[model samples]
Target chain A: MTSTHDADGDLAVRTAGLTKRFRSGQVAVDGLDLAVPRGAVYGFLGPNGSGKTTTIRMLLGLAHPTAGRAWLLGSPMPDAAARVLPRVGALVEGPAFHPYLSGRANLARLDAGDATADPRTSRRRADAALDRVGLSAAATKPYRQYSLGMKQRLGLAAALLQPRDLLVLDEPTNGLDPQGTREVRHLVRELADGGATVLVSSHLLAEIEQVCTHVGIMSRGRLLLQGERAALTEREAARLAVTTRAGQADAAAEVLRGLGLADVARDGRALPGGAGTARLTAALGPTPPEKVSAALVHAGVDLVGLEVDRPSLEQVFVELTGEGFDVAR
Target chain B: MSRAEVLDGPGAGLPVAAPAPVAFARLLRSELRLVLGRRRNLVLLAGLALVPVVIGTVLLVTRDSALSGQGPAFLAQVTGNGLFLVVAALFLCLPFLLPLCIGIASGDAVAGEASAGTLRYLLVVPVPRTRLLLVKALAALTFAAAAVLAVAVTGLLVGAAFFGVQDVVLLSGSTVPVGEGVVRVAGIVAYVGLSLTGLVAVGLFFSTLTEVPVGAMAATVVVAVVSTVLDSLPQLSAIHPGLLTHHWFDFAEFLRVQVDWGVVGSGLAVQAAWVAVFGSLAWARFTTADVTS
Candidate 1:
């Protein structure tokens, strides 16, 4: 199995012990070696104050890291910023623009900042981006008058002004309506389909769980778990469920413990046999269930059924971080 | 996945930055849109341009009141030579309004963007920090030029309408043609515009020191006010030559029969020195800033 902390392969963003210590003596990011594979919808999952935004800031060359190095699209940061940032689009923290200008004008101004943007095609690019986010209707309205959802969409439009290799969106769904949130999910999936790697940071697990192919969970400025979404849950230690007659519950529990299981419990579940049945469970370690079943049968305990219950992603995260995630929204 | 995926995609080798001029043009246009498009800036400029008109109109109303020579040095001659109104208007505005206006604009350059949360976006646009600073300096300087010209042109039209055009009497009691008078007025406008560069540099340095636009603006105006006050003290006359406002009225030197290039050149040299010193400090602070906003 690949190590979760390894950043050895074709990574769009690779940081080696990236650390940010503010002048206030606060350590915002601590030794974060974040690895985001190319063409991945990598979710940077963390609660508020988990250093997700700080990490993104460091990656984009906005803030200098105290004691580490980072590379974007295979080039060193701030050094290769002029070269690398052109191929990168970012919406860090939130969308910000000249409040007095119309949405279209703000976008044009931002697009013009790109060195590769053609002056003649600037208007066209800005219009196309606004249209893509379904913001064409209000494109001419002053940005300060835009709704929260509209502002977020405008930020997304600015990021889409150019076809970028990597997009680092910090809380892209912030302040969006449910419909707007769904649209953003679709947009992220579409961008990934078009071969763009997206590093989206969010405090909401559901937001990350639905769209991310890879997840890196962080807590208190430290990354606790990182891996592909499905692989992470599959990699967790699943529990085992065992069923037998109520009268034989104690024997089955003893037999499982004797066979080297942990947290052995005989769940008081009444089977169709009317209180004559028992449901036993335990933390399934390396010991195979087949061996346990045979051992139970030889020990004269009635083993009706036995199987491993796959662990959920929530369980895996909670286990690793020892902190609950806002998984609801 | 690798860099090949991004590089081999459609429009992969799109030049990261256009040729130098083309790229600079884009940065310049966007910055112009921002500085000129802002309502607050427009209001500030209109206010700066209003002073000359107000002065011209007041002088026009009181031309027969015997209050002629009671005001500024050139106010007495404004009725005789309309161009002196432009000179007097600049004299009045220079003491406070001009520095205050440029201080607000220049001070807002970095701190405004920082407070608005746009500084991070601009930096991430990969505008090299040095390049962004250069564009900002240019934009503020452009606004300064516009401010001074606004005062001169408005003062000229009002003065011309109030008093018919004629020869300009030099401080040496000699006379020059009206055409020469207009040219000297233009030269004064240019000189006054150049004079504000030092203040712009000071404002920019203050802007780089904080994320609060109001704080930078206030600090910049304070520096200008302090310089003016310090230049006023007779005991501090030793250091007056080094102050930002000391040579601001040197444009008056043009009212002389023979222009003193020595005085004007030294004034410009002081501006250059200020730009070199504070401009470098601004660059250092900005390039090293964390940009958390």
Candidate 2:
């Protein structure tokens, strides 16, 4: 990964050597540095066992660091949390509400203070936030009566009502179905556009790759990689195709040796079509597509058609994770 | 209210002062609303409010023969079997039961959010740990008062109902008439409030210590029970009186023939001492605890 020191007052959060360990001395978040700019949708990505949530908690001062420091909105964490919190909002870990309280009342009850909110105004805010999250119809319904996705929305609504500068959401889509997930993804983009700094952590790399301007990856309590989303996946290579006379296909493979494309295989026998025609596959490392195509034509062995496929983020994930994970099915 | 005001709300150039009393009071009110707004809490309050009426009726029903044997003097005095039962019920049971309930209520106040994952929401918002703990403690204290009053009011009404309102006899053979007895009872109610202050603090302290509701409730109850048991033993009586639970029943002696103001006063002092000691520790621990767990 490429690293450079960038000096800018635009950072919403900055941390150096941040670490946390539980009572058993098991480190949950190791020494790590993170920089998230204001008004940026930062995605914290990692596997299930990674410390994404732990890092977020420490950033909010909900949890103390074992041996490092962090700052939010230009102020030190925990001590400065109070001064900065009024301007920030967040939903972490999971969605929970007082089971007996209506969804709307739950938000209204989360008091900025007890000036005794005008019930009407409080309801309007609660309803508006809920409606924004598509939970308006369930506003009066008790939390226990709602589904998991609805509860998640209720939590998001509570955080949004504060008119804060930042929103920290952890696994906000864990229990969501496809539809709910799409809605939340849209909301994240909309909130960012409206000028809220959003820091979301999730195991869904594809989703993160789609919405985040910046991304950080953690594993085994340590940050493995972080940077602008575009720069992280630059290792994509090109795909190649070849066609040659029947038995001559094997001969054509030897001629392309200098390109470093290996493991060439033919579609059928290495014999020509009618006279001699064969097809093959090659692993090319971001080689020029036109060069590969022209090389085949120059060989005098009949060249058919060639195609190239660029690498995807999924491929990058596998490379980072040591290997592609196996699917249960 | 004006178009200009509406348009300028975000950048109106209004200098924002530090949220002082407004923040604190709003926090306190939020706490009160949470504790008092629940139906179950109200039910508990209703039960306490009707204690006097219940006692009056039970006594009126059984007053014919059993009433003749016990003098109004013994009835007013808290030393007799009936009043002792009342005192035991309020002082012993309430502290154990009510504090447990309050702990149950406030126990989940912070940790529940952690477990539910909403603590992140509150923490991320930067609510001061000290202020958060204070608000929670205030909530528990309000519940504690309600819990204590429930027992005291209920006990007082039963005593008045059964004994037919008369002079209260002190353990020292001193006597105070019904008018004075009422004043003393009010004082006793207040004392009960003070006595449970430590329990409230304990529950709240435990609440911050762990994320489990049952764990907090159990810790608070166990500490109270153990302390009370330790204080009840005659072997430890000398040192026990200094303990908060030791003087929990000191108010009972007030109903005796001669009032022992010295003992009652000592009990109040002990209660206050426990409150300060436990309260300070609670705040300290809560402020330093890591919210991740």
Candidate 3:
């Protein structure tokens, strides 16, 4: 086990064919293999009930896996859960606390339960945590009286109580308002900047797109893709759309076909305001935009406008997972 | 370089190592706080304490009525020896009130956390599932002991206030010194508490079986009630000694002069067996159950 740890200290999380099946015969998670690099704001993105939370539960040892195994920071799980979990902070699903206890008292109780936490300093740490989350004003308030955003912030505070090597936040901004969402995203960015690997799960592509340095997309309990954000975006195919004179559309299509562009197609809709110009779209492979323009100009085809349309991460995600990305999920 | 080393090298601020595994003692302390802190549990305890007050007041007000000779063997002695009020309250409570309270408390132990969504957080502390279950069981038992004492103390105080403390007469038609009588009352209280340990274990087992606290509580009480029902039927005599509540009243032997150790020993053995069996079941269920909430 230490072999993996020694070979890649930068790998904060690694799983080998991890799987979980409920007794009720529901396969919550299929065989999943994942690796999260250290110091990354890694987004665990998947639709609701797509096994994102289930996988997180398995990673934290909250649920037992039917097959395979996982390692957190190089420590094998369930076996090293006690040692590994203490180094990791997770806010799974959502915030949950004793409704009767004040937020401060809740944190105090949780902190006391950690053997590494100094009881004498728990109060100080709790106060600092509340302050960090901008919840200092409501620190003494009972958790039941808190708003949804406040509860989320309190959960964030609990995760930040002790300095951690990894933070697993499952939809930390689920119920937060716009302002609260911004605050949590900013916090995630800061935590990663401070060198802590953060695995933040969310169904919203835009939410993770703004803060995550790396991403893993899942659908139907299986991981579809995992990599740095830039690499994934770079791998997506860019399309070239050319506006040509109505009579020259077929000519341009034939030129692109002759140039080895097999995916070329005519735009279904006429140009804006029913213009006579025809729009032709082609999948741009290794060919450069300049080369396509020169080819059109050389062919004596009337080229009105040419543009390269890059696919957004959402599009790439949908293409890979074969499902609509519902932010609410 | 390791992530920790990078974070510690410059502006990462105060360096902190990974937290250590939580101690069982700490988990237990937290569990106790949760059990005692709930208003529902507190109200239940207050209600248990009220039982002895009502019994004592009713007995005091009707000292000359037919009620004086109408209840348990201890009831006739209540007016003569105030300590019997403690005995009478335990007698009344053991059958239903005591077990009801224990069931509600223990039943809420695990299921309540699950329903409230706190179980996930607690488990992610990676507080070994077994350890969490153990802490919950220990807290339930603590509540059990406290509940029994509450009823006994209230009975003792109310009885002493109305009838005055004095030497207690044995149920066997013998007399004991006042000091000896005090020791016997303490013994009776301890015995009553020990008798409920099986119920606590059973309640904890039910708690592990559901996420709904009310369901667990009702099932636990129903199980105990059904056992009592089985114990009463003469047709079930062969299984009487095996019933969970069959020897619950064995503490009454403490009121006798000779103290029938044979009966008391068997009662304790039966409770021990129940605890061992049900406690194992609870541990098994809790450690393996899928906490989807």
Top-TM-score candidate index: 1
Tens digits of per-residue lDDT, candidate 2, B1-293, equal 25364235332332233355666676677668877887877886776556545544544565565463353333333333233324534644554666556666666666666665555555554456677777877887888787777776676656644544556555566776757767766766677777777667667767777777778777777887788788768898778867657777666665666567887778778767777877788788877877764
lDDT of 2 at A304: 61
The lDDT-based order of candidates, best leading, equals: 1, 3, 2
- Candidate 1, residues A224-288: lDDT per residue as tens digits? 77879878877866789888888888888899899889999877656655676788999888887
- Model 1 docking grade: acceptable
Clashing residue pairs for model 1: none
Q: What lDDT tens digits, residue by residue, belong to model 1 across residues B48-161?
A: 778877887787788888775578688888888778878988898898888888988999999999998888998887778887888898999998888888888888887888
Best by DockQ: 1
- Provide the lDDT at A77 for model 3: 75
lDDT of 2 by residue, A70-154 (tens): 8776556766565556566678777767788898877866644422233346667777899899998888998989998898898
What TM-score quantifies how close candidate 3 is to the native fold?
0.87
Local error of candidate 1 at residue B177 (angstroms)? 1.1
